[model samples]
Target: MRRILAIGGGGFTTEKEPSLVDAYIHRLIDKPRPRICFVATPSGDNRAQIDKFYEAYGSLDCEVSNLPFFNGWGPNVIPYTDFKPHLLSQDAIFVGGGHLRSALAVWREWGLDVAMKEAWNRGVLLAGMSAGAMCWFETALGGPFEQGNYGVQRGLGLLPGACAAHYHNAHVSERRVNLLAEMHRGLIPSTLAIDDFAAVLFEDQQLVKTVSWASTSTAYRVRQQNGCVEEAPLTAVPLQESLIV
Candidate 1:
């Protein structure tokens, strides 16, 4: 099945070893020493983030690599000529967080969006946190609007509905409010809001479950019913329990 694991937050970026969310991601890949590639385009291919990715996955059982767009092609960077083939060869692809509008524009300009779609169709696992999580849905909240206004941002449409990442995270209180208001005003369709340390799993474009390393973190289904916006929490299975045997 084509699978996408959209994480609202928490992973190597915030946690250390014994990270339940990262472990769950690794388990989803069925290969022995799975080929996992990290795409940090959203972060403008930030070197620090790239370093963090390597540091985190370097000791793991899988073979690790990354796709860098900002840095010119080199011995380490995958050349544009092999981009599609290289992506398709991987068992899983992880995208990093950054400016959604800028990231999406770059993806389209480089045709990486198409390549990603092809990769998903070929059964490669597509996953990421925050901006990465928001990239797969038809619509997402959080945009490059004026004065940090939260607006409806279109995504790759790999999954249905809208999404709000870091939902209820105290740092992004504005996002929480805007998403609900947008739905209440019928400005956007029903949305899936994911809190830090939690994630929503989709297989064949259908939400299979929500999982979290943080036991208290969960996903929410937000929608407008008769002018009232409602937030319904989806019980999150502990990541450890959701892992495949």
Candidate 2:
């Protein structure tokens, strides 16, 4: 079954304790030393994102490669092979988070979206944090921070309904609330809000698991009840809760 392990936030580039979430993602591939690829196209293939990816994945018992789409990509993605083949070669690919609108625009232009869907069908786990996570859902909330308003953005619809990242963040909690309110107003049917360090996992098309890098993290299922927003805490199992395999 195709799977998506969408992380809300928290990782090498975002926080100090990034290892837990990254390590958990590797285990989900369930292979003895899998080949993991980093897709940094979202962040304009930023060097720092790639650097931190290696910094975290380097010590793990797996082979790591990167797909850089900006500024003359490195040998891993360009001058080495074609697009679809590169995506299919790995056991998993982790997308770096950045501007969602810009990322999707670039991906579609290069047909990486089509390639990723193919890779997902081939059982390569599609995973990411923030914008990376939100894009997989049918709809997502995107905000103009300066204006303090958010609106729904269409996603690839690999998963249904709307999705929210950084649910409990200090600076961004208002955005999350805005999305929930929109859901209540019937602008969106339902929404899934994931706190930093938490992830909601989908196996095939069914949501089967919620895991967190930190115990404090929580996942929420949000919807409209009567004329108001309704929210319930999802049971998110911490990554340290048990042995993955």
Top candidate, metric lDDT: 1
Per-model TM-score, in order, reads 0.93, 0.91
Clashes of each: 0, 0
What is candidate 2's lDDT per residue for 111-216, written digit by digit as tens? 8888888889899999999888988888866555323346567777888888888888887667676676566667766789888989988999789999886767
Residue-wise C-alpha lDDT for candidate 1, range 1-245, written one tens digit per residue? 89999999888876756467777888888667888888888888887777777767666676778888786432256775569899999999999888777888888988999999999999999999889999999986766433335667789999988888898788767677777766676777888999999999999999999998776899999989877999999988988788858
Which ranges of candidate 2 are over 4 A from the true structure?
A: 73-75, 79-81, 145-149
**Candidate 1 backbone clash number:** 0
lDDT by candidate, in order shown: 0.83, 0.79
Worst 10 contiguous positions by lDDT, candidate 2: 72-81
TM-score of 2: 0.91
Best by TM-score: 1
